[model samples]
Target chain A: MLEQGKIDSRQAILLIISLVLPTAILTVPAITVKHAAQDAWISIIVATMAGLLIARLVTDLSLRFPGKTLFEYAEEILGRVPGKVVGFLYIWWFLHANALIMDEYASFLCSAHMPDTPVIVFFILGIAVAACAVRNGLEVLSRFNQLFLPLFLGLLLVVFILATKDMKVTRLLPVFDKGAIAILKGAATPASWLGEIVIFTMIIPFLNKPKEAYRVAALATLFTSFYLLVSILVAIMIFGPNVTGHWIFPTYNAVRVVSIANFLERMESIAVAVWMFGGFAKVGVFYYAAVLGSAQWLGLKDYRPLVAPVGVILVALAALCENIVELLDFLATAWPPYALSVFEVGMPLVLLIVALARGKGGEGT
Target chain B: MKKIAVLLLILLLTGLTGGCWSRRELTEVAIVLGTGVDWMEDGRIRLTVQIARPGAFTAGSEAGARGREPASWVVSAEGRTIQEAERYLAMKVPREIYWGHCIILVLGEEMARKGTGMITNFFQRDRQPRENIWVMVTRGEAKDFLETYSSLEKTSAQAAGFLERMKTGYSVQLWKLAEMLASKGIQPAVTAVEVKEAGITPEPDREKKSPPQKQVGLAGVAVFKEDKLIGWLDPYETRGLLWLKGEAMKGVIIVPSPGEPDKAVSIRIRRGSTKILPEYDGEYLRFMVRIRVEGDMVEQQSREDLAKPEKIKTLESEMADELKKRATAALEKAQNEYGVDIFGFGDAFHRKYKKEWRDLKDRWDEEFSRAEVNIAVEAQIREIGLLTKRAGVPEE
Candidate 1:
């Protein structure tokens, strides 16, 4: 085994959430709200279901080749050359997803809190920290996430709760006004965010009890969708339909508006803290996967040597968006069907079907 | 030791790269307390800001050293838009301008009339002054409001902010303003303000009272059509607008006493809720508004045995009628005069008739103007003062 560390089922669940949640709350609300209007939350529910189905497909396939990562199973099921091509796509997807996570966190920080700071500073600091975690391997990443992700989520919940005074339930009125098409379109945008659960394929082989992969998928989906739902729903309730669609970061803006007791204001500082931890955890997960997958694809003995060079490449990729507007356009429209859905769900489903058809890796444990 | 090395590396990375890139020292930035926007004669925007003097805010540090210097500095500059004007204004300030502490935004009447769509959108898009700032419309130039020194507070902006906080008037914050501006159903309105004469001040050099020292006063609400200011709603009409909108009603309502026609009765509205029900006939639309209120008798000028059941009933009816009249006046002004639905009737209609709203959404103000509005009120007397009647009046 190239990697020796093991994470229990609960830690697996936590790691999956840490992967999907942080950036999901930031960009998904703005993108989803624009498509679905007031029904963005309904879109979120639909997206959650799609995400769960994808998670299940990926989990079932990874379990069939017990203790084997997606990269290894691709080689077993598709044979060497073709499987390596598929393996390269997963590697690219991991890099692209990590780049996006880093880009969004930096974009938000620059525009919201530190405009004078160049975006690359955040890129360097974020990826540099994440690289160290990647080099230390999965245990360090998941354990750090376990300690930080909960505290981050709690702060977000507090921000929403404090903003309850300003929230008008009527803002969510006239439900289904845009009908099913808009809701589905809205769901499609965040579906990519939720579909990020497919990363569980990488972690399933590392779970101490491999059968617990189903529990991991179910729990991560529940947490990711719940986080997306509350943040998007709270944003719509607080900012209304027309207003919610226009903000680049409606959740952060909604968080900023939380003024309680004349003292609990400017709470976006807490938001910065949450994003920092989230970005670190998110970048950690994807960077680890990318490093680990690349090592396996090349048949390397250890993944640690690839960490620094990959970090440099990831930073360069993170800068490709140019700015938040470009980044958002890519995330909302360009990335979903072509990149996230295909790799996260479509490819996994195809691979699963192929494996079943050929009777490859049949409960080989 | 390994953990320490990793911790040290992480600390050095954040300490060296992330925080320093955007680090701004407190002394390097000018803290703005209020922002003022006025329309120039050429239709350009003249941005004015009130910056608090750090030394003056230290309680007594600048006591006599800066004899007549106000506690804040005011500066103005002009450009085609707020950003351009801000850029010009920044040329004059010695330090980088900061808006985090700016608690108020004043719009000159001219700017409010010409249109505030762009101005509201500016606040909506920007990150600073992030949303607690209360917006107000001044009857005169916003520059004057921002420039005027205050004896009541450290600065005129603080004084005007205090006036809005008094809560006797309709005030909207930046977020609410943005929402209202973006929302199609409800037009926007904000607290109206004006420069007023507070008292005369004697000048040692002139030996005469300086033009009665100016202060900012709360002046009703400035209503709007889309983002253009249409007109003002007086205090009475504002109260009615509040009731029609179903917001919690405050302030006092005075009515003529039932039998004692020569005197007046005062009721302090504690809290109330309103329900706006919309009805559509074959061709026309009708809105039924039900307002339920709870109030206390704060003052009774006529001793008509006010606590008696029949008298209380008469008093309640009179209160209800008075409330209905105010609300009707507000509705008429909104419909017949301005034709702007600031009461959110369009929203109420949409909430009920989601299908019909598709067609009506475009021409809502027209539909709102033509709709028939009927207001119903129910008032309850929650409490009587120390005595069932006036203290001076003979008890039954």
Candidate 2:
């Protein structure tokens, strides 16, 4: 093994929370509102169910092969060629996920704060910080998340508390106005966002309580969805469903309303800071997963050598999305059912079934 | 060592590239305190900005002399669009125009009447201008209003902003205007300003200096049909609008005392809130606006020991009647004359009957015009003034 590091279940859950919550707060609400209208919160709840299912598939598969990542266990279950194909697919998924997150981070910061600065600068700043965390390895990455999670959550709480003064409960009226089908359509984007918790497969092998992986994953998904639900609710309450749907980032706009006595106005900078920390962690985890998975697939002795090369490709991929509008269109219209469902759920569930059929690995100690 | 040289080079480079590309030092930037828009005769827009002079407030600066002019400068330029006008302004102004501190936006009557559609794009699209900044319309030229020096505040724009916060009228911030424009049934309402001669004549100056010049004060409200200004509401009507919107906090209301024909009692509104109840009976849509007010009697000219419970009750009823009349007048003008639903009755109706609202949303303005409005005001007189009766009046 190129790296020797162990993270307990608590760290694992925090990693997933940090990975999933920022996207939920920043981008998912607007996308969900566009499809669901006033019922966007319902869409998030439905998506949470789908996310919990994906988490179950991943944890169940990881438990079958103790102390082995998906990269190692794939070959054990399938033949070598097929295993490498699946491994490559996951590598692609990680790179694409990292690119999507980077796009969101860059677009938000550029549009909201630094309009004169190039989007590429934001990408460079983010990936540079994330690259350092990747080079430091998983223990450092988990610890980084553990330290920043409170600040991230604290800022989110403050935004909600300040915005409640302007919130109107009547804006949430006319429930089921669009009916369930529209809400289900809205569920696709957030379901994919929460399904991102399947990144736990890479960290599961290093868990101190590997036996409790299911419980931890379940709790993490529940907590992430809860945070997302409150955020979406507050967003809809502050900017009504009609206005929120039009905004590119509803939660950021909600934070813009955190003015108290004119002295504390324009405090969305705090939200931007929180996102920077959260974005770094998210990109770091995905980048780390990609590097580690590719190294394992290549049968390399160490993954550290691949981190920088892979980081370049990740940044370049992120730069491919021309602008915020194009990225949002891709996220809403294409990315969900195509890439997210296949990798986060399809491949993992298929692997679990094939492993069960072959009667391999699960019977061991 | 080579490493030491690299570190020192980085430190030197850090000094060279100090504050990024967009950084402008305070002295080098023109801080915009207010902005105004006017429709020029040549089919162009006149953009005016009140830029604060940084040296004016700094003690010991030559510009900070007590006898110097006011602490802000008003500049205007005309162009096809506001951005072009601003760029034109950039040509004349020495410092870069910074809009981060701009707290007030004023639209001239021509601009307001022709419509606010063209002028609002700069504020909406620009990242610098905040969304919560107060937006108002001036009775005459916005440029003239921006130039008038306010007696109370250092800058006229600062005075306008403070007036909005003082609850003299409904303050429509940029975001609220955007919200009103986006919503299905409501139209935007902006506070209005007028340049008036200062009521207080400067104490007869020994040197025979010019008397105090004209200053800007809150006039009323500019009511809109969609985004175009259709009419103006006087201060009393603006107060009525505010009462219906639940934004009326502090204002004086004078109502006729119970038995006295000429005398009246002035009540100070401490707090107020409004609730709208809508009833739909398959054909007609009726809205009941319930205004609840709590206030204290500030002046009683009747001198009848009006602090007595029955007198207070009578006073409360009289106050309620006065509020109802004002609210009803504003509502009638909005519904019948302008055919605009400025009070957001449609939103209230939508909240109560969502499905019905969808069917009615297309013809909402017509429906709103036809809908019968009932105004009910319940006022509570919490306390009388320092005295119960006039000093000379005999107690009965």
Q: How do all models score by TM-score?
A: 0.95, 0.95
Q: Which residue runs does candidate 2 get wrong by more than 4 Å? A: A363-365, B1-18, B59-65, B201-209, B394-396
Q: Model 1, B145-246: lDDT tens per residue?
A: 888888868888888877766677787888888888887788998888888888866678786657788888888789998889989998889888888987
Q: Give a tens-digit lDDT track for model 1, residues A305-334.
A: 999999999999988877777888888889
Please report, in order, the local distance difference test score of every candidate based on alpha carbons.
0.87, 0.86
- What is the C-alpha local distance difference test score of candidate 2? 0.86
State the TM-score for model 2: 0.95
- Give the best candidate by lDDT: 1
Candidate 1 local Cα displacement, residue B242, angstroms = 1.4
- What TM-score does chain B alone reach in each candidate, compared with the true chain B? 0.90, 0.93
Query: After aligning candidate 2 to the native by TM-score, how far in Å is the CA of B235 from where it should be?
Result: 1.4
Native-to-model Cα distance after best TM-score fit, residue B347 in candidate 1, in Å: 1.1
